[model samples]
Target chain A: MEFNFPPGLILVLGAIALPFLKGKIQQALIVLLPVMTLVLVWWIPNDYTLVLSFLDYQLSPVNSTPTGRLFASIFCIMTFAGGIYAMGQAKILELTAAYVYAGSAIGVTFCGDLISLFIFWEIMALGSTMVLWAAGSQSAYRASFRYLMIHLLGGVVLMAGIILHVHTTGSTDFTAMQPDNLASILILVGFLVNAGAPPLSAWIADAYPEASPSGMVFLSAFTTKTAVYALLVGFPGATILIYIGLYMVFYGIIYALLENDMRRILAYSIVNQVGFMVCAIGIGTELALNGAAAHAFAHIIYKALLLMSAGSVLMMTGKRKCTDLGGLFQSMPQTAINGIIGALAISSFPFTSGFVTKSLETAAAASQGMVAVWFLLIAASAGVFLHAGIKFPWFVFFQKDSGQRPPDPPGNMRFSMWGFSFLCIAIGLFPGPLYRLLPYPVEYQPYTASHLVTQFQLLLFAGFAFFVMLPLMKRTLTISLDFDWFYRRFLHIFAKEFTVKTSNTHIRIEHAIHQRIERFIKRLYRHHGPHGILARTWPSGGMVLWVAIMLAGILLTSALL
Target chain B: MISDQDKHWFYRSSSLPKLWMIQVFILVIALVPEFVLHHHPHFQENGVLVDATFGFTAWYGFLSCAAMVIAAKILGIFLKRKDSYYDE
Candidate 1:
């Protein structure tokens, strides 16, 4: 316990060697790296953890708490699943970055001190941005830049908060606390911004869609879920998060409804799904936090599955717009079916992974006697089916025939899809394994008759509403405005035109003032300018008289004023 | 009425009525849980009255979706723009 190596560092540092290995060697390394990390992560118990010293401060580098193990286990599983899916398809550069990104997420899960957390957090930002930039398209590059800016700002704010928090409390332990003080509030803002909370929730939808096909699968897994992990550890039971999480839940659905790109619809659903987890965290009970944790695990599987299915379509057809994709179920049945499982799981259809996990949050809400929250969560559950469960599949696979008969993607892609598809059903059918891994002990059962009946009625009727009101729910070739409107359009345009005009006016007025000042200066130059009498060399007697005269004149002016 | 020749079996217009029938059956079956099961309220609140009804979830699901769709359509008036809106 005196000294121990972090499991994440193995995968992250292993990424440096990724470009060197090729074909079988690279594939072996890719799969083996996570396996090795998983072994290392669990090999040490919670008691056998290490603390290091640097510059009079103690830093806990490897924290193997129950919650940390749960997150790391899921992250390692996701990385492996996503890796298998992206095998031989994604660019070597993107794979390398993804490995680093995922490893950093695992690192964050195990990090015990704010110092180690901040470092791992930054590495995640760098690694994820690299994954996006590896998309190699112009728009992907631009999106990654915007994504980096937001994360960096979040990192800086978090760093400052950590510094202030440590200075005030004389400890760097990362734990739950209300954001009552400035440092904690700043820290909360930092965490919320990353959680895709408010104003910046748009970043998930904005950046995730721009990645390369398989690249999006990896992109969807790590970053925000890691933020959910951070929030669960740092701000459990914080009241403001309830409002933030609720806002994100609805915001994601409404935006997804207006979206035309199929992948973007899935991306928006990521925000929506993550919103459920965030709300649960805000509920802040042991059951609620466990719900958040379990939901994050389930969301990773299903969201990645959805993105993988969409990515398969995009790769096969070379078109991402929903208007251009339909009747895919005929040709790419597996892909379509896989996408449907993901959709059902995401919408929390009974016996799906989401059903097992998200219901925990709803139950938590109910237990707390928060009637409105329970109602809204139920509505959001239905809305989940309405927008993602129905809209995504209907537009892509079952709508008016676009007549595009693209085949399913490569073998690895198919295998990956099947694997995640299996996990979704397996988890849904028996949530015991996931529940046992949760931070808290479990007595909650997902298969109660009341819960099952209520969930079915809610989902099916939402399906009915979707078809009955099909015209209103028609997909348009359009995008909707979000809070990023300020940075993306409004503030950008204002900074462009408004600042230019103001600067121009100031320059013009300064020039006019200079012209007027020159006249007075010219008049004075006759007496005191460089070429005037004051500029000319003077005798000692004249100098003394002039000094006396100037002093007398200055005294007279002061007296008069 | 899509006449595209390469269309799948599911896409054939002849299957429309069956699909509709299936959907209607699904809606009908949704009420079974309400009729047979004792719907437990999370908060045990007796006064709100929504949970007490047999088919309240089905109705609530439909109405909430309807409200959301209507809200989205209204908001679309101001927020929806061409897909290339952010391109510039």
Candidate 2:
């Protein structure tokens, strides 16, 4: 195959030089780079797969399957929107890291082998961690460390799985893999960890919120979505993910319901949205895969839209908790409006972007006769509406008048929010373009009389429940416990206790050993020192006596023999 | 009684009414696709069941929101803490 300079690489390479530029040049490059990448991705011809030989295996880095291209396109768009939103406020270091993080995500999208994917995956981890640290707060630094540990652990698991998989299959092509072998299952777990699957899901809420306002916007886009892309490519039909996804759906809702931090709530909702995509991937039909892909595309747009609004709020108020903020609609009108659009879209309200995308997955389950899965997904849909769709906007913008009135964000931030909000509606209103971009041919339709009516009832009833349950949903200063509690609190305490106990044991053993050594040394000195027989100036007399005894012993021995 | 400086700031601020209009506009925009463009092909074609599911989501979301508000009101009867209730 002919090698042409890949345009995506050039954009990222250009962005790396952005920090060196001053003021307007830096800002222009920050916005220009992602937009150029998006254009490159959009203009690239379809079905253009590329292969290269590496270490006796073929590496496919330019795989332009429809699914891969669609995800890549949106990731580029996210970078553009996020960069614009962050352009004014973010430090140069953060802006650079964000570009690198976005670039690596795009790189992963183009990778067609596990090795290539792994390389880009780890790049994304490190790059995003840098973004977190660039938040320029002590809490951000600590959180970035915790976040790094989690990703590093995930990277180790993924690398081990890749090694075993290459050994088992004698190939490293990243493709739809079955869980028939231990290696593939390990690979699945590794991807799931990054996907914010349970037990490890705590890392996302713990880390993302601590990031800078703009940093969180970029942070929200790449990592989990990359995992979804990986899952779509490999282990699509794994049935267990259905349940795991359902668990995450509820986990996000319940925790988000209890959360007070505005960004943290949105962070939790990211897991919830990704859970829908994971579930759809598990359903593993053409329609379901389309749903997963479409949802992911739509999710990144709306989720970023949400985070951008929240970022604006945080920027204005210097506060994150819901209780500390209210009546912000009085000050930041544009933000409030854009934020509500984001909320509506996320809730999958009829005719929104989420409405068009999320349904295909649930439909795929029903068509497959997976009754239990279908029911649970329906309930989870309600839960999504309850926690993220309503709770986020209501508390942050519309609840009691907290008497704090901050102005709207800067132009760049508003533009970012507006851009994403526009896409959310455009896609909802014109899903034909999105469906055409799917990996498979477009066939399924979202609207029907019965479909519309029932969806309305479910979401409306869920909204009703939210208001009725407002007492329970009050913003609390106390944090609800989650799986991270195991590592952050319990394990820390256990380690401290173990360290104390082991040190005490070590001291006691050292004392006993020292006493024994001292006693032995003292005995040796007593026997061998100057006052003792062997050390005396009369040692010649002792030597004679020893010789005489030796002669007596020798005579006796000779007689006995 | 409110201070004169506070009154002046409130009178001069563009926050309250502007925020209200923004929120109202957002709600209106959100409802547009639902009420006005509900029959668009994109919404009509993904799947009937999935469409139904979104419909359910709407009802479920509204009910939950309503419940939360009522519950907050009820909890205010006894459990409502001072703004600094949890502070040490």
Residue-by-residue lDDT tens digits, candidate 2, A271-297: 988888888888899889999999999
| Worst lDDT 10-window in candidate 1 chain B | B40-49
Clashing pairs in 1: none
Highest lDDT scorer: 1
Report the CAPRI category for model 1: medium
- Kindly list the per-residue Cα lDDT of model 1 for residues A339-367, writing each as its tens digit: 99999999898888999999889889988
Supply candidate 1's per-residue lDDT for A218. 87
How far residue A302's Cα lies from its native spot in candidate 1, in Å, is: 0.5
Candidate 1 runs further than 4 Å off: A1-3, A502-561, B1-6
- Candidate 1, residues B32-81, lDDT tens digits: the string is 66656776555555356568677888999999998888888888899988
Model 1 residue A468 CA deviation (Å) reads 0.8
lDDT of 1 at B48: 66
Error of 1 at A541 (Å): 44
